[model samples]
Target: MVLNDRIGSARFVTKTNATTLDPFKATEQGYLGVIVNGAPQFETLVEKVHNLRSVFDVRNLRKLSEVVIIYGYQDDPEYMYDAAISHHADGIIYAGTGAGSVSVRSEAGIRKAEEAGIIVIRSSRTGNGVVPVDKGLPGLVADSLNPAKARILLMTALTQTKNPELIQHYFRTY
Candidate 1:
């Protein structure tokens, strides 16, 4: 079950012409209702709806926060640093390889982001498994969420608070 938390995921509700589905329309006024996955074989759509409602109560929706995701690779960390600094990002998700293990350059960049008061979230690029919490990272682990979902959750969390401790709690709980 690939559960996408992005507001753009409303395409799942449409049986056809998915391109016609508008994310802004779905979330602009408020969550009108659950958009059931049109694929009948995915019978768990109802449960997914219930879970979504329980986890992200749209009634309490607030302003969207700006969270950027940085992809980790053998490349330099300059891009990561730029996202936090130049973009004035409120939060950042580092898509690290395997268990959210950071490369040396990425680590250096992350520290800079932290120093800038941008909440950093460590997410897995490998697409599965929880990022084990590392006290030395000066950031929150993404739990079982991948980079994309981590960005979404971090954006939502930043809306509530900028405290890394409180944001970390959201990472663990949500």
Candidate 2:
């Protein structure tokens, strides 16, 4: 089955086959393409969809905020994190090496970003594997999501709230 989790572009629960698609349902769920299944076998709450859409609408109209993804490397210089802060990014998804571990210098930059009111999410550049919560880490973990997916969720989560706990909950949930 083509589950939403496997379809990189799917925003919500979607199932597809060869024929018969529901464009309306896909649109409602924030998808632009066709779904060959009847209705979505799984559905997200209307309230949730509304909230996500509202945030996207405001962002699209004003361009007041942005979400950035930065890759971590050995002996990292932290320039990308600093740049994100300077650019007024609303959120950052740090794709750290191995299980989302950043170099000392990069961590310092992350701390500065957090101090600047930018929410930082720790994800892995390893492509697959959960970035579990580490007490030593300065930001929320991205769970099993890769950097790109983490960025998408972080962008949506930032719209509803900046509370690290709540955003972390979203990472664990949707």
Candidate 3:
């Protein structure tokens, strides 16, 4: 999307579209619902994302799906495992806490997602860097893009392919 405005002789324009799905409608009134594995790690940042003037002009806010954001309790691998196993998602993003790593149970869920033909990738909430593929990790192709941006990327990736290598390349090219 392109938006230009003039503030008393200062002219400005900016663009924010990254993914191709266009899951967001252009409305300038949207909200993002976040799902976390444990506590509210994004308490300060969420406020910033929502308060950004551009967000309101781009799309309206919506409630986040709670099944994914399992906060305020133990981070069970099965909760996500079950969600993917039950076909509740076309793609799943495992936002690891650091360096895009996963729990043992989380690994089990990831394997399940892959076996069941659901697109799966690693993500990190740290928002500092992209998730790199683990060389020895049994099944993961690559870190789920950048953890901050994995969910949207996964949604778009799933729309194209389910093969791990193809999807891994897609992550690199995307």
Model 1, 1-174: lDDT tens digits are 222332323322222234654323322222323335643233223323425544455566656788888888776566657657778888889898888888888888888888888888888887546789977765789887778878888887766678878777777666
Model 3, TM vs. native: 0.52
TM-score against native, each model: 0.65, 0.67, 0.52
- Clash count per candidate: 0, 0, 15
Candidate 3 whole-model C-alpha lDDT, 0 to 1? 0.48
In the range 26-47, model 3's lDDT, one tens digit per residue, is 2232222223453222222222
Please rank every candidate by lDDT, starting with the best.
Answer: 2, 1, 3
lDDT scores for all predictions? 0.68, 0.73, 0.48
Deviation of model 1 at 47, angstroms: 13
Runs with alpha carbons beyond 4 Å of true place in candidate 3? 1-75, 138-145
Which segments of candidate 2 are over 4 A away from where they belong? 1-64
The candidate scoring highest on lDDT is: 2
